[model samples]
Target chain A: MVNYLAGLDAVFLALADPTRRGMIERLSRGPATVGELGRPFAMTKPAITKHVRTLEQVGLVRRERIGRIHRCTLAPEAMRDAEEWIERHRRFWKSSLDRLTRHVESGDKLTLALTEERDE
Target chain B: MVNYLAGLDAVFLALADPTRRGMIERLSRGPATVGELGRPFAMTKPAITKHVRTLEQVGLVRRERIGRIHRCTLAPEAMRDAEEWIERHRRFWKSSLDRLTRHVESGDKLTLALTEERDE
Candidate 1:
């Protein structure tokens, strides 16, 4: 459980940056060399490399050296845990809201009955 | 676009902490008083308050005062933007993988044709 939380921490921290999110977006199209990933950004090569490193640390991207070029591809499965975490909460909240809706729709008869029992 | 990214940044940062995530989980079940929210953790009231503040900053929870007590409830809608952001990328990666599978299944005919055309 601790390790799971740590993984979530890393994933969320890695995704906190817009530059990193943009890199993921580009990688989603297909794989690309470091230079290609850096092209769309105004930052220097080292700066882009730093962002890529953060993503790699969180397992969001996998890098391979092909000749002198470093190619990066989206590690889609790394996102599964984070996606599932969010989805679980989303479903929970949705169901909670549904329950709340039903309670409200049922009106105050239950509340009144409980109050009467307490008074007795 | 910038504002949207900022929202994501805040949401992810807020979620990066396990304590905050735990509080969110509790809130998922129902509304709770500030004291109730702090009961499960070993942290001080101020520490818990700090976590709650971060969550509120991201609109993840809504707090209201009933007399001297503060009631906090999960603001599930606040999660909508973050959920959508992750879902979009998740869908993109899934489709990209599907395309890759099709390309590999089709074999090297396209690759050979491209190479021959380049040579000609």
Candidate 2:
């Protein structure tokens, strides 16, 4: 599980680049051959291929070798683990805030009393 | 707006570090003074301070100067924009999948008909 998170870290890090994000966006529409995907880029084929490899390592994109061409498609579940991680912490924050709200409303009388007793 | 996204890129990139993530997780519980926060780490105060500054730059943490000490607190909304960016594309993917599902279920009759007409 921790190893999976580390993989997601690489995915997120790879996606931190505009070019990579653009590539993913394009892939989302449908699978495309490597050269077709590279048409819009000013970068060299090797550079684009490297980017694609990084995406594949993270499972954000999967490449299929059909005949002489490599076709790439989006992998929707690539970021699912990262989303789950954020969601897990989101629940924690939500619960903490809920508790804080209740405590604020009730003035946390027990804690206040303990502090007062300590002061004396 | 793009500049804001770039800021979030730096924020996410900064957070890609494990040490930085640990610092954030600790800060989330509550605010802590610099020395207090650095106690668990083998790293120096300057190193910790640099990490905190990176977090501060991304608005993930805020530092308060109280006399000679600095207190750092988590900034919850710092990642909100990044979340929103992900959400915006999430909807697109959802819609695209929905359309694909519908097309599959309907056997894409219209597309087939159009292709047949083109062939004729």
Q: Ten consecutive residues with minimal summed lDDT in candidate 1 chain B?
A: B111-120
Question: Global lDDT for candidate 2?
Answer: 0.63
Q: lDDT tens string, model 1, B1-118? A: 3244678888988877888888788777766666677777798999988988888889998887756767677886777777777778878987766755665478754333223212
Question: TM-scores for all candidates?
Answer: 0.79, 0.72
Candidate 1, residues A35-118, lDDT tens digits: the string is 777777799999988999989989999887756767677886777777787777877897766654565478754343223212
DockQ top scorer:
1
In terms of lDDT, the best-performing candidate is 1
Error of 2 at A22 (Å): 1.1
Docking class of 2: incorrect
Fraction of reference contacts reproduced per prediction? 0.52, 0.09
Error of 1 at A38 (Å): 2.2
Q: In order, what is each prediction's RMSD in angstroms? A: 6.2, 6.9
Query: Model 2 over residues B1-120: C-alpha lDDT tens digits?
Result: 123357657755765666666666665554566666666678988998888888888887777675676756667577666555555555566655564456447864524322321211
Leading candidate by TM-score:
1
Off by over 4 Å in 1: A1-4, A98-120, B1-4, B98-120
